[model samples]
Target: MTQQDRRRIAAGLADGLSYAEIARRLDRPTSTISREIGRNGGPSGYRPQQAHQATAQRARRGTPAPPRAAVPAEGTREAEGAREESAREAEVIEMAVRAGLPRMTARVHLDLLLSEEGRRTAAELARRLKVSPASVSVAVNYLVDQGYVRRERDPRRRRDIYVVDDDAWYHSIMIGSRQTLEAARSSIEAAQAAGLDRPVGRRMARAGAFLERVSLDMMESADRWRSLLA
Candidate 1:
């Protein structure tokens, strides 16, 4: 996180923005912002400088000394190479958020993407993100419902783990295309039934036409992409 990000979080808190809103402005996951504040005295006692210093100390402990010529990237990267990979993960999560995903949902997707074992138990996610199991449960459930993730029983551990695969985006796009097509149909019907003249009707008709074409195009494109990956 950057100093600017910390300051923004403090400002957001003062302005009574929700954690999700703060994460959106910072281009970070809500769990990340929540955990940061929770660990640093739960908002009331939180100080940006102290939080930054504490994060630096933790990074120093986990990271080796950096070469003199190397400057860390955006304060997200530390002396260790792992931090660089983490920074990249954060970038992916932010991109997902900007694509209209909820912050916690995006974070869960990132956690699954970065897991070495290809899956993670809910308990592990909650613990790592410093969130309640209920929060993880809700996020994972939403992802599962949206076909972005799957839950499977881990017989060895006697627990369930969430799994994500390379085809996840394909599923998301296909579903979105279908929904867009449905909405376009409804819009066209509403516009026609209103009995409005050409001016207003023409505008709605054009929008519906555009949506119709794009929806079909998205489905076809997704199919082609899936074929290549297959």
Candidate 2:
């Protein structure tokens, strides 16, 4: 359906209009209106206005096409962008999870990233993320493990301070680089020992070599950048 039609339907839905009423007004099938609302908003709480606004915002952000044409012609660009943004958001949350962070902890990490000075106290983070101080502590610890954050004792205050430094990404990359190089080297050596000289084995060895070299370069670059920053 057209963007305008979607917006009208959304508005009508927000006004607590019935599906039949909205369909009649928009000259569309009741099923169409029902699907639109059900797909966009949950069943228990559906807001037409909110859905319409979300649709508009998605369009403005230039969404991409979906894997399947579920909402075909229904603001494809906007929907694509929204889906991508949601995915990225989920990824960030998942990163926190893999780092042993709770959902609330993951949210706090995101808030800190967007926050000024890139730092916050346990209590502040707890309040902002609507969690207890203990939960904040857990989250902060997870971030520290992932090399996304650092904790320091605050001399003036009793509580500790968490900081996201410039080297955050570098630290994470370096850590991963070490692991990747080790794994690649092991794989290449094993492949050679197995008397595997076929195309696949040769390709694997070549890729492993490339990864090792790239890891070295990354580490060197990180060291140089750290020295410069220092």
Candidate 3:
């Protein structure tokens, strides 16, 4: 994080914006913002200048900076590092929750996402998340139903493992775009049925056309960029 990023974080906190919203504005992950604040005196006490100076001091002392990508929660070198890592992950879970996922669902997804295999059995998930097996079951079931996750049977283990693949985002985006396009089609058909020559019908027709264009544009852009996930 830069001095400017710290300033924005401070400003975001002052304005009562959630870490997730601030992350969106800064184009950084919510975890990054979370760690930055956690190491620097926290929300009510954050001062950008002090945080910058402290970071500079760390650089001078050869202390490594946190990685932008998520890190494993276990095996951190120091207690402080572990705390920061946990805080970062907590922020990510909060962001997921804000995006409409239930808390345990978000936690389960984050755990699988951070794992080396991009997958986990219910036993492992329950163990790591410290939640009941039932909780993991409910959360993973919900995710699978929403098409945000998938389950595969582990032949060797004789159990099911939930996997969050790279294509999760791409698939979700396409599903959303398809739904919007369907809506656009329905609106356009209705407008036609009502006679586009009429004033209200003309308005509806124009709106539907706009929706159609935007939906198609979104689908095209998503497909073009989907390769980045690989």
Candidate 4:
């Protein structure tokens, strides 16, 4: 879609127009509008110019089509289906990038999540993303450190598969909770050391209290929502 189209959609949303209404005004199919907005972060987070730029970047990174081989009718249909999925995957990668993930990191994360087993070896991820294995290694390592991914050794293959599963979020949230608790501890200690009578100490104490509460709430929410995610 064009920048003008995006702007119109944003305007329509601000004016409280329904998706069908926006589609009608744009002279585009309703599905097109819905998909476009969804790909760009939905109504709440959509940025017209950023979406346009992300699309352009994807076009620039486009790989050449592989030569067609002789195949049965069903195989040809499957190939076509793969192409459609690739298009959707490209949209999702762009959206993830706009949501603050680095492009390559987003690509790797999506590939692992989409895989049948929710995992891929570094070599496999690199091959799929058309990047070096070292690049994939870096991305996966970062993800592992952040608890968004994990590694499991495949004994036969003698290689590790980067994985994303329900446990990934659990690990990530728990890691975040620990960090928040640490922050709370340090800030409160600083407040005490600096003297609570001082303005800075009082401010730090308040901040620490807030972080402590937030950490507790995060742990509670994770426990509450864990079953659903599982």
Which is better, 1 or 4, measured by TM-score? Answer: 1
For model 1, what is the alpha-carbon lDDT of residue 89? 59
Instruction: Report the error of model 2 at residue 92, Å.
Output: 8.9
lDDT string for model 3 (67-167, tens) is 53456554556645755566677778667766888767987888888999898899998776556789889999988876678889989979998999988
Best by TM-score: 1
TM-score of each: 0.66, 0.48, 0.58, 0.62
lDDT value, candidate 4, whole model: 0.78
TM-score of 3: 0.58
- Residues 1-230 of candidate 2: C-alpha lDDT, one tens digit per residue: 66678767767645645556677899875655555654564322455566667667777988731332344354588765655554455456556555665556667778788778988888878665545677778778877876878888988767798988777877777887788889789878866865566877787788778888988898888887886545
Q: lDDT values of the candidates? A: 0.75, 0.69, 0.80, 0.78
* Candidate 2 segments whose C-alpha is farther than 4 A from its true place: 1-106, 132-138, 155-159, 198-200, 227-230
Q: How accurate is candidate 1 locally (lDDT)?
A: 0.75
Q: Cα deviation of 200 in candidate 3 (Å)?
A: 5.7
Candidate 4 C-alpha lDDT tens digits along 119-182:
8889888666666788788888888987999999999978998889988998889888989989
Q: Which is the winner by lDDT between candidate 2 and candidate 4?
A: 4
Candidate 3: minimum summed lDDT over ten consecutive residues — where? 66-75
Colliding pairs, model 1: none
